[model samples]
Target: MNAALLIGLSLQLSSCSNDFLEEETYGEVKPSEMTQAANVERAIISAYSVLNGQIDGASNAFNSPDSNWSFGDVTSDDCYKGGGGTGDQNNIHQMEIFNANSTTIDIVRKWMALYEGVKRSNEAMRLLNASTDFDPALKLKRAAELRFLRGHYYFELKKIYNRIPYIDETANTVADYAKSNTIFTSEELWGKIEDDFKLAYTDLPEIQTDKGRPTKIAAKAYLVKCYVFEKKWQLAYDASTEIMSSSYGLLSDFQQVFLPENDNNKEIIFAVQHSINDGQASSYNGSIGDRLTAPGGPFYAQYGFHRPSKNLVNAFKTNSVGLPQEDNIDVLNSDKVDPRLDITVGRPGIPYKDLGVLYSTTWARDLATYGEFAPKKRIVSAKSPFYVTVWPYVNALNYYIIRYAEVILWRAEASVEINKLEEARALVNQIRQRASNSTYVKTLDGTANAGNYNISTYTLPWTNSIEATAAVHTETRLELAMEGHRFFNLVRWGEVDSVMKTYLAVEKTRRTHLTNAFFTKGKNEYFPIPQSYIDGFAPGIITQNSGY
Candidate 1:
């Protein structure tokens, strides 16, 4: 099971009847009391465990996945909430249509799960600081690791909630977490997340003998991402160039990026490691939250909730010379498209996952509402040992939180913003070069290419920053489509208003469910703070985002 054993053995907290910010402990030994060397290490492992976003007693894991699929992908022009029908997990459907509110169970659970991560991180650091027998050098590394993880948890929270209670090791119990989301300004909160990453970059080793631990390069990569979100183009470019110069680069094939064999391969900067058959009867140690995407037909499991949209599929279209087409044209099955499209989305006749089974249009659970294509990432082969046939249809494939390609794209974006057009074009071309050389999806007999796989790199230098920025953005959407990054990327770029309006206007003509779906400009930029948490405190004790 590799590092999955850590999650299986890591200590977990019991859910209190109140908000997740308030947690009660179990047993006689408090986190401070367990200051032995081995226990301190155990606490470190526990901090990493929550990154997978699995709550022991929570059944609706889709409400809060570490992948950010629902919050990031489905809400944008990337995908749709495809299930048996619209009523299935309607809260997410509401979110998909931008009808979100403070009490969305999905939003509530996401808040709970993120806070649980903060809780574990605080507990682990407490143990580390309290430990009297642990090795000093190892304790420093472990503490840095916990800081990176807690920074990660808070980063996701900030992206989703905009303003969140930034808890750290200083807090211990439920009473200690009475701090409000208003204690720090938005800039200050960003600084706190940045500070953790900076300290982690200072202390963490360049390489780890273990899996899932953040290395110095990983911390730097996260710093680049934080800078990207804050629009600090110079800082993003500087930090991202350092990572690009490091050992990380694109894999020869894009498909290999998500393969189980390359779970923590050289390309992956950080990921929440998943494992199956780990002796957990529920198999929650695996990619439990992503089980709904299994697009079942013959041997595959049957939820099929995260189906790719027609808009996203058309985005893969390539011109005759192999470049992204202008958005005005409609793409067809016979169109000359990018090679990465077939590898990304499952078309009607393309072989799914290189398996002998040809993907049938009927594989889509709800064709009338959602499109025919299903998510191909995060899915493993049926013959693999990691695939488990259970209610969740879980697998051991690790969900990549950050990969080298993303860092490259971030740098490209930063370069374009800083007027380094040629450098940005070269950066985008680097990713495209991998896609052009990479393998395409196989046919039914595995004798030939599945579709018209035509993709090429930028042969011309970009002289215009505006066009160059568009190209970089398009390259990112094509390379990282359906990986739960589209919406957040759009939001950070401040293009959600224009893009969603155009997308909803056109998409409603195809999918009837989006007829009334709309995105309110400033308000929809972020979700509302969960009402329950606000109710638990005084009127001004906790602050809520505007337009809630």
Candidate 2:
């Protein structure tokens, strides 16, 4: 068979069109295709396809007020105020957290998307195991890719539902559901993910790839991140360190990282590819970027759903030069802090000179920006004249899952955990240099006011290995802000309680207009696993998460 023929077989093995398996028989190739390999490889791409739908568009994930302050919907980090309190319905970020009736459709879609990915992957594995017609080397590589994609989908599911019914090739008849065990220990599931990634790293290509496929680098990068999730710090360090030294390096200009022109730029370890021409039509993809970014152009300006918090803005604005904005400043000045602030945060009326767009005060007026003002989170827009349209969806900005900057920080953190403090300090300084525009900032060595604000000294204080592990992880919370890593990172590091008690509770109280109606953090850790899923399966084997 020709290369195209083999590639076609891979497609048949994994393509999204269910007709491939339903209407047609196995081993049958289309007019343009010939080999089983082509169809099988296509199946792998199907698995990759699901990542495009995982993100919540309007107010589900990062766009929620709880995550960002500009939306003004967050009650407390831990609790939802009400379904209609702020812009809860309109707030895409809050929708992901609260599980409202109107927004459950997207959640179901996400669940279905993941299962589709798993089904395609299983079919591919089944074909490979049964066929001797495909080339052994190519077959192994394709299989590895499928496994990686499957594990990735599972990891995403794990995060959202935390103990979703684990399914693999073992799933069979409806009656088989009773015999099947969906209750997998977290450790066991993480083990499966690690193994799949290891196989992927061994088989994937080291060089660059097309828009959607996972390169060797992407697999390795995610492996490090997952390792961090599993508390495998030393291994995470080793994996991230390799990527740091590889061809990947920080882009000289940070702004380019998000530009449409730089969608598949070298610094990106892995990102869900979206095309301007023929992109995924799912709500998660098209037009969301333009909607959030346009501020007030034609596409529609819903209050920039994802706004920066005062705390986050202040954190990024620390003196970049390590020197006070003036002389021996008692408190940190936001005026002369990290330069990335403007790039990350969008304040109303703040014009971004590079992008040639000004933040409009328009989205604030639109109730469509988030959900019904909810007791849980508030959805506030900047107030724009334009109305939110449900047509011709097209999101321009690339949603990055991992980047060179994160990999660098991951390396720096691992270095410290291994007692390589000097190495850790050097990596941390690299980030500071970019953030500060080339100033030597103080190390976290408990030194007295080494940089800008002499008001307080910053040093990591953790008694045990676990606590120290958490502190380094906290750096990730600050460093990787709004890229959708906060809540999950908190859960993984077992620091959710601290974030709730110390940060969320105080932040909520500080912002409340009515002192009597307050939010708390007691019973809001994991979201209620979609009730529908539990009801469907026999014996109702799928149990809800704790405190749901």
Candidate 3:
């Protein structure tokens, strides 16, 4: 029997959920038993199905193929780059965003789905532990796979909504509540998350027959991430060093990493696997690329959602010397953009060979008029109601939750914390090298299209180097924005002020473009914990984050 098949065998044993669990199916399992191995294999696919497009439950947000629009719709620092709106003005869904109630819905959906995933994983683990049918060796491997899935899910939950109730076991009753009796403290919970990942690293095979499942390397990469989150810099550096030294170097082409054909590319440390059969196909074109690129066609238009911020589009443009244009240019013009401007955002005139045989750009006038229909960067077409109507790319490209490139960046950032600048620069340059044809350009004057004056200019660290460090950190923010790193990176750096402030300035500067949306400092940083959870658990027991 194939070892890969063995890895998925225990998923077949999931029993039907009772009426209570039924009420909250959340896509983890079906009521009927899956008796056949083929059906069981399908269940494994179903496990991946629950990995939603975005943690926010706003579909197709941040699954952008290219960074086109600013995600300013959510924060004052940014504004909607894409255009188009469903005619249903009565739809309260978009309006409810940022409200305490709306945030609660996102929290509930995320919490429920994560719990469902954990429950399914627990069932698989239990069956693998008790099964006598499979060979002992194969059973152990299967157990590792289930544990990895459970740990990954738990980690994701904890990271997104801190102080969440941790359910590691198969809870058959209310008495089985870990949060009530055996709960780990917030600090201890991080340790538990780390331990599970560590065990997953040990028991899981170094390589797997399946492309989507976690391997030892994926566990290692996540371990590094966990360590960084906890501020364990040396540990993160060590784990990252292992990944860098492993057989997990980047792919030959950076663009291929996001291509449909490159779903499980070598650069991917961990990705929520999506397939065509289970709703993945239903939401294919509504992805980030679709919204960004499909504009101007009868089939698709209303492009410019996730529109690249001048901060980010300018990020990719380099002078002839390889430095970003902002650093050296006297004044940066939006139109006198970088070559990467085409690469990162879909404009009317830019030719994207990767998208199709066509070369096109959507004019500003067209975007202002028809951008409401555009979902740019999302897989969904501009015509669909599910267009980039929400902040972030709401596409179904299966979230690359963690990639080796991020691991590299994390290491660099952590190194900076530990007073290691050269290491940080090297890592940042590694990412730049993949995006550009040449070496790391340090001088700004040589950036592609230097004549454009609208872009900003800041010198790299020549003396104090802190400015350069700040620039590198900003670069990470620009390069990875709305991909879901902006808020967290701000939190991690103790620099949420700058990000929020910068975003507000950008919004104010573009007030005519933004209309009524302006960012406020205290309110937007961390999302308030769900009022429902607080009301259910206890306002005193499970307190909300401050100022929520």
CA lDDT of 221 in candidate 1? 96
Compared with the true structure, what per-residue lDDT tens digits does model 3 show for residues 1-548?
A: 12222112222221111111112122344534443333343444444434442222333323312121221222322223344432211121132123333244434444545655666666555444544555667566666666677777777666555666666655545434424312567688888788878888888888877666789988888888888878898888888888988878766554455554566677877766433322332343234222343344433443433344444443445554546555412223343433333333444433332333233443332444222222232244333333434433333344466778788888877777677777777777776666554222122333443223122333343334575567567557544544545555665666766665655455445434443333345654445556655565433556565466
lDDT for 96 in candidate 3 is: 18
- Regions of candidate 1 where Cα sits further than 4 Å from its true position: 1-33, 173-175, 537-539
Please write out the lDDT profile of model 1 over residues 247-327, one tens digit for every residue: 887888888888887788889998887777665546677787787878878878778888888898889988888899857
Candidate 1 pairs with clashing backbones: none
Top candidate (lDDT):
1
Q: Model 2, which residues run further than 4 Å from truth?
A: 1-35, 54-107, 170-172, 175-182, 279-299, 319-334, 353-357, 360-363, 366-392, 437-475, 509-523
Q: lDDT for model 1, on a 0 to 1 scale?
A: 0.82
* Per-residue C-alpha lDDT of model 2 across residues 1-548, encoded as one tens digit per residue: 13222111223221212122112323364733423666655544555544544322233322221122211123224222222235444333344333233225544545555555566566567666656678988777777777777877777766655666665655444443332235568888888878878888899888633565667888999899788777687998888867877887776665545655566687887765544333233333332322333233323433333333444544543444332232212223335544444455444444433333444444333323221111101111223111124443334344566788888878766776787765665675565555544222332343522233322112443335454444355445444655656666666656666654555444444434222332234434444455555564424566666655
Candidate number of the best TM-score: 1
Q: Give the CA lDDT, 0 to 100, for residue 469 in model 1.
A: 88
For all predicted structures, in order, the TM-scores are: 0.94, 0.72, 0.72
